[model samples]
Target chain A: MPFEVYTFRSSGKRLFAGKNTPHFHAVYGIIAHKQTIMQDIQTEMRNRAKELLESKQAGLVVGFTLDEYGKPTPAFITDPDDVGRLVWNDDCVRSRHNLVGCLKRDEVRKLGKPAVVVNAAGKRAFNVLIAESQREPGDVVLIDMEPEPRDARFDERYAKLAMLDTMSREERFAFWKKEFTRCFKCYACRQVCPLCYCTQCIVDKNRPQRIDTSATLKGNFAWNITRAFHLAGRCVGCGACSAACPAGIDLDLLNLSLARAGETHFDGYRAGENPDTLPIIGTFSVEDKETFIR
Target chain B: MPQIITRQQLLALIDSLLEAGTKVATPVARGEKAFFQYLEKGDAPLIDPAVFPVNSTKEFFFPRHEILYTFERQGTEVLVTDARPFVAPQVVLGARPCDAAALPLMDRVFGWDFQDRFYQSRRENTTVVSLACAAPDAGCFCTSVDLSPETQAGADAELLPIDDDTFEVRVFTEKGRILFGGKTSESDKTGRTGAAPDRKFDAAQIRERLQTAFETPAFFSEAAVRCLGCGACTYVCPTCHCFDMVDEGSVDKGRKVKNWDSCQFALFTHHASGHNPRHDQGERQRQRVLHKFSIYPEKFGVLLCTGCGNCVRGCVDGLGIRPVLEEIAK
Candidate 1:
């Protein structure tokens, strides 16, 4: 009842329309529609995870669940009984590749248990591990994800990128300058990213301090550009970095712009599509499709 | 003296401050979350403080990045020029009470050895106008730390929204009195205050349990297992003041900048020879709690936390301090 003040409007009317009203019914209908879709996917995911955990097929099932704050967070369920805790929602936008990437470490590998996720990110991360010689194909188990609509929560992410694309060079500069001003160098983007799995991140090294950790205008520009450039062709486009950022920086745009450039210049070299495909920068082709290069 | 001011009068005060070349920071909605940013001249600030902002008012005081000094090579001579702290007079309007209370706790650390002029100057320059929180979130535990919605610890002035259009302004300091500036009219409702939410957690019980917490490694380890070791919790925290000084730009021509640092990171304690006293996640987690509850209270007689719950809200894994405190109390 303490939160009732939040619902009460300035005129003392409830913020939301009355439950019996058409407006309320319509809103409830939309919510119910979305919930039904979510429930369908979640039930299947939970059942599969439960089966895997119970059958000893996987040691852990990396999934999503609501935290105490009602925010979706990564859940590591080892017990079949705990599979009920797993959920599927728009907030679970993180690419599970990073979770799987942890298994490659010797400390985590010693646990001797496999992990499963119903997504492309986990599979893509596993492929990157294989590409890096950390693991071979079939070393990890990835269940085929159900047909879910592309998360619309990231529409603003793409829209911002599009808006930046339309802006003049000076306008673009000013836009990014304002955005980068919010950067705190928390490294949440790098930490959440599956591909940014360097044992010693360049920002962390101080002997030759590669990138400034301070979130100053010059320092942020340097650090952000370096981070985006590093993942040019390799980024999985999972939207994890932008999703995890507490600053709300539109980093997805940076990655997406680079991803588009990689696709255009490298003859549609989409990252995380095929495990065997040579990385755009990793291999040189005699029949390279760089006719635009003067 | 406590005074009454209409919502329009408050808005006009903010407008006048902006017109008079004073930087006014407020919680402005950007994208999905509201962050504390300096309001532009025309922008109307949000009246509801919304419990707490995504980013604390700490940014106005101790910025995430600050240039300490710049060095330039002038043909065999290195020229150094100190970067003075920006001390322009400013106002933080509609600051959450919990966030306002954190300023004094930060003042203790920044003023301890070498008086950090950057933090001290901002503290002196900025006048905080805090709005009493009407709706406390699930994660809020300000009452546990001896702070309430009406607790005016660090705020220059406090305002309680009586209804949609009026606010009861209570000036605590000379800075606040000057900011109000005779605009507030005398009204019958002078000393009236907002209703505070029920106490969320038992602070005394938690404090007692923490005294003997160090001996119990198992308790901390259990909590540490879920931690992703991300700096989200500390960076969003109101009182986490640890920082790292590094030279940005080239050795020939660049600046020495101080960046906010968190103990949650492995590198926070890593030495040149690869020796870390707080190696494990459990130890690191223990240090954070102990510092907030034990060390801070022992030194400053105030808990280091303001219970703003930004850490809880922004935590990547949802590792809230309330549950941890509850566990310790148990």
Candidate 2:
């Protein structure tokens, strides 16, 4: 059975309900196996963090630590001995969270170099940040979570997104409209995205007031659209934004649409796939395929 | 003497209120989480005391975004129309006692200087019915903030679960009594408050530390590094009531509105002169603690936080008040 893709929140629910197609089945088994993976990777992560901090290879280790509530939370450890707090788990909500984004923060910057934990998607976004000139490759170290290179694991990212494609355009619009209505402009969706590392977000600007500041349906639509478009060709499909939304909006679906387009329209170009290659958005191609464009 | 109503009767009560043209807000299950939303016909309200809504009931009184007024230009003559605050008679059902307590704590702020009719009107028109916590999670710290699962600070009435079939209603105010008038039958079986949430910190100690910790930046910045600087925690909180006002729409014709703002945002204190007193996220974090513990309490004679634990639950970064306060007390 193929592994179903999603966070512990929705995935556990759907798995318990015996829902979703059987093609993406045994998500529970995969999660259990992922825990076994955690045992090995957690040891590896702690070792790497310890090495980085002890040798001063990195001034800070941005990783996951269990909070008092036993939830996997983002932690910053500077002391070499504190590396034991580091962890890797299937439910590490911070697993896909691009801890690399923390390198841009003042408090984190004051600590010198950062050694960040990153899954495939997090690594992709890290590369995107570099391509966009928001970061330098030398600025932070990446400790990859995947024990081995597995594009098949990344394939699970679009399992639910594939289901959404069955809906008509009107149905899609209605689906999103209802979802956007719940948004109260908390900006959790924006704050969590690695690609959305804007110093002054468009929503915050009031000089010309690019978008409505209200949380009205129209205003919310505007906000969500702005957030989605801004990350177009750049979003790494990390699911952090969707997981972060207290409104329970599945924002990753919007990113999936753009991500799939990035591969198709840009001749199999993927954001942050290669550090040496220029970004699809930043560098335009004369051979760029487009049916919609005149 | 307390009055009793069966589970079926309580749901019927919600339907009856909606049928009678009264707006009702309750936790309605949506996907994996529950949210406090207005109930319509056939909408199932989560009456279970264990279900904590992701968003607060504060929006019922102080909406996320509300029109202050509207204006238009007619040649040399200017015209203005004041936005009448929505004051429809509403019933907030199945609110946690901690959430209910936020109302009175906030009332002091809204009604202190200039009676904010927007909030005061809703406060006057609504009756809050809180469900006494039968099952409190680790996130809950209501007991630490001078509130219990059955605290009646702002609730008009309190519901106690006798079993899956029954609830004992304890009326606190005249408004609560009138709302439940004739709906309940007198019963000797009192609803239990259940186990109290284990106290996480002493509110007095936090307030005391905050008084001196104002100048100490490390205490706050320790947590600030991980804070994502989003409005999630503040918006979900029952008592975090900071707002930004702006004229929305064109200059010729538009409405002035107040929208929810958060101290966590970098721009919350950004000055017109490009100077900010709260220099960093650490300062902002400090302000949040000091305001809830020291500033508001010094002014209102009560702690600003009700310890509903929504902030902890809603924080995307998993950073919240309890952890910070506990760190301080330790």
Q: What number of clashing residue pairs does each candidate have, in the order they appear?
A: 0, 0
User: Lowest summed-lDDT stretch of 10 residues in model 1 chain A?
Assistant: A1-10
Highest lDDT scorer: 2
Q: Which stretches of candidate 1 lie over 4 Å from their true place?
A: A1-44, A89-112, A147-160, A284-294, B73-77, B190-199, B215-219
- Report residue B62 deviation for candidate 2 (angstroms): 0.7
Stretches of model 2 off by over 4 angstroms after superposition: A1-37, A93-95, A153-157, A285-294
The digit string of per-residue lDDT tens for model 1 on B110-200 reads 9998899999999999999888887877677787788877788999998887677888888899999998869788777643344455656
CAPRI grade, predicted model 1: acceptable
DockQ, all candidates in order: 0.40, 0.63
Query: Could you give the TM-score of chain B for each candidate, in order?
Result: 0.93, 0.97
After aligning candidate 1 to the native by TM-score, how far in Å is the CA of B136 from where it should be?
Answer: 0.6
Per-residue CA lDDT of model 2 for B64-149, tens digit only, reads: 99999999988997799999977789999888888889998889989998889999999999999999887788788888998887
- Give the per-residue lDDT of model 2 (tens digit) for A183-215: 998888887777777778998888899899899
